[model samples]
Target: MGASHKKPSQDDSNLEIYSLICLDPSFHNNEETVKAQQQLRVSINYLKIFENCYQCEEYIRSVSSYNRFILIINDELARQIVPRIEQLRQVYSIYIHCLDKITNQQWAKQYLKIKCLSDQLDMLVTRIQSDHRINDLFPVVIYNTNELNFHFLYSHLLFDCLLRMNSNNKNKFISLCKNEYKNNENELNIIHEFEENYSANQSLSWYTRKSFIYRILNKALLTQNIDLLFTLRFFIQDIYQQIEQKKCLYPIRVYHSHLMTYEEIQLIENSLGQFISINSFLSACLDRGLALFHLYEPNDLQRVLFEIDADLQLNDMNHFGYIKLVNYCEETEQIFFMLGSIFRIENICLNDDEIWIIQMKLCTENDCQLKSIFNILRNEYHYGQDSNLLSFGEFLIKQGYLNEAEKYYLRLID
Candidate 1:
């Protein structure tokens, strides 16, 4: 105990290895393509800054007044610094330009070795920002690719990491999330790996990791984590059905996670501050909040209403306060609650009989409790421009409503 030694901060620590990335000379001429290259640089720089903090480097400047000159590598310098850039097999991405294929594999391997590390994706953005030579990070041409191979590699590595994390290290991983994920950044990373692992193990946990993953995936397939993306599709649906079957403690948790996706959320951010989810649309209508999209059946509507009510009464999510302010005690409550329960379904199960039966319940019934059933029925019936209208009408006839059922069939013929 002669001397107490303090560890270096994240900024001052030397990088053991640098994963150098460069653009193909053929892409240099195209302005948009060149822009994407520079953007990638900025994103990389951002990651370097992040590493400084996470690694606890000693050289990082004070927060109040700090120069952004740390690890500033220019693209022109990148060209001169790189010894070689090779075109590898197409399995990795659009083009592989680096010192060695092994380096690329090493970079790919790191994501799988840790949790939420992929979400530190600000590197691509930051690199683009710092590299004045390039203008765009994500170009329009790359958007058209049917399957993004790079994203697939990234996701596969992450899934491998999630699969590989030891049971004893669960607490360590959760602690990492609590430390790193302070903002909206890395939210998707938490969803992709942390949430999946936690849910599978029931030992690790985070507040909105499940919902965050669903929202991010609904956006563009940017994260490039293919294994996680495919796994989440089924994982989300399974959780939703679980809540329905078990009447879980957190139903909105399941429903929100089910409906929202990264692609959809990204679109909403670009177009408007609103997002579209099968569940959000149904939940909004059933709660009589804001109708974002169409509701397929009564059950869909009921699920949203139930979750909203439960979320409110439990004092968990009263952001909209649908339970407090809205007078669900009125006639609208019946319509909202009943229709919500009826419309819950996936695309495959949205059969003609189910639609017709639900619609008939809304149309023919002249209950004293409800006044404007016709408006709801007409609006919901016209929602799906499908060929199943006739079949649904036939279902109504079988249920003993001849006159009321004729309108749907006659409209189909017309």
Candidate 2:
């Protein structure tokens, strides 16, 4: 708990950062506690450790109002700090871990934000992991980008610009990874292996390995963490390139199963005739029956299956693939659609088994009326035919991403 604080980078000032903060008397000294904190850091980007309760309180109060914070405190400090931080608007969820659950539960049960007051370290980790997933995996729908239509012009242009830029700085990216995983031995070794052995050819292999790269990349994309995204652009470009190279040559149908809240369910149901743009890489399977294995009924969330249709014959960036490296098991036939994939909602209905089945077609400019919309986006965003990297900073600047533009130019100067 010495100096593990992360000051938000200026480029990510607009982004909503998620942090896991642990306030323990001596968590770092214990081997098991170190491992648990390592696990939390593996998935979460920012983690702060503090042995002093007073200092943590000051830090929490200093954090921005827009960011999300999850806290873990021992029963000893829970009583001291719970009443103070419980009412703060930035506290998302709190977990009280202690040896005496019976005594702690008596008081923690009344707190609205205390998710769990458990004696089991494993149970405490499970609840935190589940809650973290709910926050990180919340899909970024294109609906909020515009009320007039769902052409997803903003996302399309964003990805278009990032992928086309040069990503040759491997040392810088690897150094960043090393700092983030310094506490975890396993991740540190993987980072070393990557530094010595990585190549452009093994892009997909590395991404599919569930390594630190995969965890941080997806989290950065979900949060629109511009600084982290810039640090990760080298691998991002390589992975997407390999996916593009391995694009299937014929029509393919892939499936993805996900949990959605009632509000998200209604948003898709009512958006049947319109288009919805998904912000991240979609991990889908070629076999519908195989995809069903990921679904389960939960009282709090609805199970939904995505039947995605892609016609690779159309010739566009809307490519999906079955990369051997990304395919964990040959039987799964796992396929993935690239980032910023746009799809028109063809249909949505509940099956007899109570699973919400959705039908969507991967769209290219030629297959639909998106040609006009695409041109409108280019004109509206100042992305003309002559646009190049010279305009990227200007683009970010015009879009109110001044700090991101600053970082982009600084990197260019580097």
Please report, in order, the local distance difference test score of every candidate based on alpha carbons: 0.26, 0.70
Q: What value does the lDDT take at residue 136 in candidate 2?
A: 45
Taking the tens digit of each residue's C-alpha lDDT, what string does model 1 give over 1-414? 000011111232111111122333334566654555445432222223222222222222232111122222223322332222111110011122233444354443432211111112244335333332221111111111112222222222222222222223234334433443333244435434663554432211121222333233322122222222333433333333323333223323212112222332233233221111111112222432222122223211121111222232332211221121122133221111111121211112123333211111111123222213323333433212332344345444655646535643443343
Which ranges in model 2 have alpha carbons more than 4 Å from their true place?
1-18, 23-45, 50-70, 75-94, 99-116, 122-154, 296-299, 326-332, 350-354, 366-369, 379-386, 412-414
Worst window of 10 by summed lDDT in candidate 1: 136-145
Predicted structure 1, TM vs. truth: 0.20
Cα lDDT tens digits, model 2, 1-414, are 001013223333322346788888777788888778877765564677888779999988886544567898999988999899887856767988899988888888878778888887778888888776654433343442224242354346556666876677689878877776667677788889999988887876776665677766665665556667777788878878878788888888888887766666888877777766676777787778877876765545678888988888885657777766533343234677888777888999989998999998888755445666666666665443336454656766776767777877786655
Worst lDDT run of 10 residues, candidate 2, spans 1-10
Model 2 lDDT, full chain set: 0.70
User: What overall lDDT, based on C-alpha atoms, would model 1 receive against the true structure?
Assistant: 0.26
Residue-level error in angstroms, candidate 1, position 359: 28
Q: Which candidate number maximizes TM-score?
A: 2
